[model samples]
Target: MTDQPLPGAYWRLWFAAAISNLGDGVFVIALSLLATRITDSPLSIGLIATFATIPWMLFALPVGVIIDRVDRRKVLVIADLSRGVLVGGLAVVAAFWDVQIWMLWLLAFGLGVGEVFFDNGAQTILPAIVPRDQLERANGYFSAAEVTTNTFLGMPLGGALIAFAVWLPFGVDAASFVVAALLAASLRGSFRPTNSVPSTGMIDDMRGGLRWLLGHRLLRTLALVVTVMNLAFATTQATFVLFAQQELHISDNAFGPLLAVIGAGSLLGGIIGGKVVGLFGRRASMLTAALTPVFTSTAIALWPVTWFVIAMITVQAFATTVGSILSVSLRQQIVPGQLFGRVNSIYRWFSTGAMPLGALLGGVLATAFGLRAPYFAAAALLLIASLLVATGLTNAALSAALTQYSPVTTEPTFATDVDTEDHDTDDTPVSIDRDPLDDLLAGP
Candidate 1:
């Protein structure tokens, strides 16, 4: 059967996620500035950043259970609405009263908590709205929008809003949350499974989810790789603003274009992810994607503040996007329907946990070695990161599995999966017959 069009509810979720991500990006700019204004210490900024991320590390698994148990639409609506109010409060504090550094940490924590639910709901709800066949394209576009909002728009817009008034982005951000809330609440279809029995306890469910995630060897390896990548990503993020300003002499004006280039690359990469996934097959793409980040991040560290880093990162973003989208979509595709949420949580927890540590470490290292040194460290980590990913695919667990489970190599899995589902819709490179994992892990 032809994949039916995405239902109205799914559209609402997509739009809501997009807008909410945009607002989050703007608020990040505001928070960083607030930290700087309050205390000039890199350590303080790192601490605030750590707080903002700590919730992700702490609450991801619990949040997944909540998302799975509740009406996802409602959970999304609540998250959006709550964020709107929280941000609005920040705006008022910034505009009408003096806001403390601790308050910034509080706000960041609240936002991060809200994000746990929002993300869990978003990832789970999509499968309910669209046919299994169309999930990749949907994921690709969704991933692109996220990159656009977080990496591309968050700082630049935040900076711009701060220029107009430090409080303005928060106000606008609050308003965006309201829009997102309304959008989320307006979705029509019910997403919860019909089974009357729900998990009895939060802790039990969390452990069950974690067990399933870690028990699976392939997924467990992938999670470890994700953790390393996240650390690299967080470290770069912690240093980027300072690096841009100090090394490249990138003013507020120049930063936007530099980021925009990366976003554009992501957009292109997103559009083409499905084709690549189909051609390279999921395993190869994941390895490539993991490795590509190292190159760009290393380039960022090695190159003095020049147009070169921007150009390199832009190219890097597209390659990185291809790898990431493929990796995520592949993980989702292979995960059993029942275990998807928890597995994602497991992946998330590992990845998210790395952020705070990376940011904190970046600050410490930067202080000692200087701004450029962190990038060098990050680059070396990324090269090691690539090896970690390569090891994951070749591991004993995947080796036994891939040898027995041969994909239809001749016609291409992408042709079958895509033709039946999203013919001509995806730009991802996919070749059905070739399994990179199988190549190395040819088995017993």
Candidate 2:
């Protein structure tokens, strides 16, 4: 299985992901630039980021349940189409009228909603499509595609497009989403969970996942570590545009290119992430990932030189991408297929949910101290997270967890046993002789 080529359907999914992420890259730069036009207040600009990420905190649990119940391909299609409509509508509005800060916030929030479903669904569906031995390689491809399109190509293109007109980037973003949607819809076969049992209700399902994650030491620690890491990173992200303009003395035209430079490291990391993990092993890889940001954040805060900042951020992106690939692959390998959506949502609910608060904190810090304040704060927080990772994610612990929870068979249940016609596409329960989580939890 490891030597075999990835199936054609996987490529279709990959293409759809690449195209949509390209639009996302464009959308991120364009949105920030537009917000800057409306206001100079760092707090207001930060609020836009806050709105965009708040949905992961608010809606992740329910959306997780929804992903497990429906055809995941349909979820991906609907999410893309909805985001396209929202972005297209925003483009039309921006062209005709004076765009307000609140409007950008609203648009960001809507897009965030679509992302909650789409991201989780994509993660849930992958193990079903490719062989288990190839999960790391497959994820590396995804991470590479996302980095290449979203940041490398999309970011620079966005900077150039915004120079033409405000509405242009948004329009391009809308079109990308629509095309991605069509490709997602073309994927064949049923993607419903095979081990889905009679419903104990949504709340119960959510609790089940939460309990399993909380009970597992390795995963639980990783989730918490990611939460702190994201919090620290988000603080820098919320204020980075302002920092570039003020401290680094970068021009608006150069902003996208600077980001693209940072992305180059991530692209490299994504391309070689699996190999790095295999070479160094997960514990060492994860520790490096945790520690790199601490020095990088401090360097940017102290120096703020353009070349120095780029160098530090590029290194930071590389380490972060490697850690992310390892973490996601580990989760996919360990968690039961039926519980993947709910557990993943819970995991992200903690990890990504902290971004809004981080954004708000960045805004406040910048307003009170200075633009550089957020970077200093991020450095402090990330240092603590690094310490946690150093102590908690030991090589022995990671190996034990993998040995305990790895699936008994490589074949996914959805490949054969799932009856597409009779699949319960709603909250209604179906009978199973034993709970999948029983086996998962029973492992020591």
Candidate No. with top lDDT = 2
lDDT (Cα, tens digit) per residue for candidate 2, span 347-442: 999988888898899999999999989989988888888888899999899889888876435323653333222323222111101100110000
217 Cα displacement, candidate 1 (Å): 1.5
lDDT of 1 by residue, 35-75 (tens): 66686566666666677678878888878777656666677
Off by over 4 Å in 2: 1-5, 408-412, 415-444
Q: Residue 400: error of model 1 in Å?
A: 8.7
Worst 10 residues of 2 by lDDT: 435-444
Candidate 1 lDDT score relative to the true structure: 0.64
TM-score per candidate, chains pooled: 0.83, 0.91
**lDDT (Cα atoms) of all candidates against the true structure:** 0.64, 0.78
TM for candidate 2 is 0.91
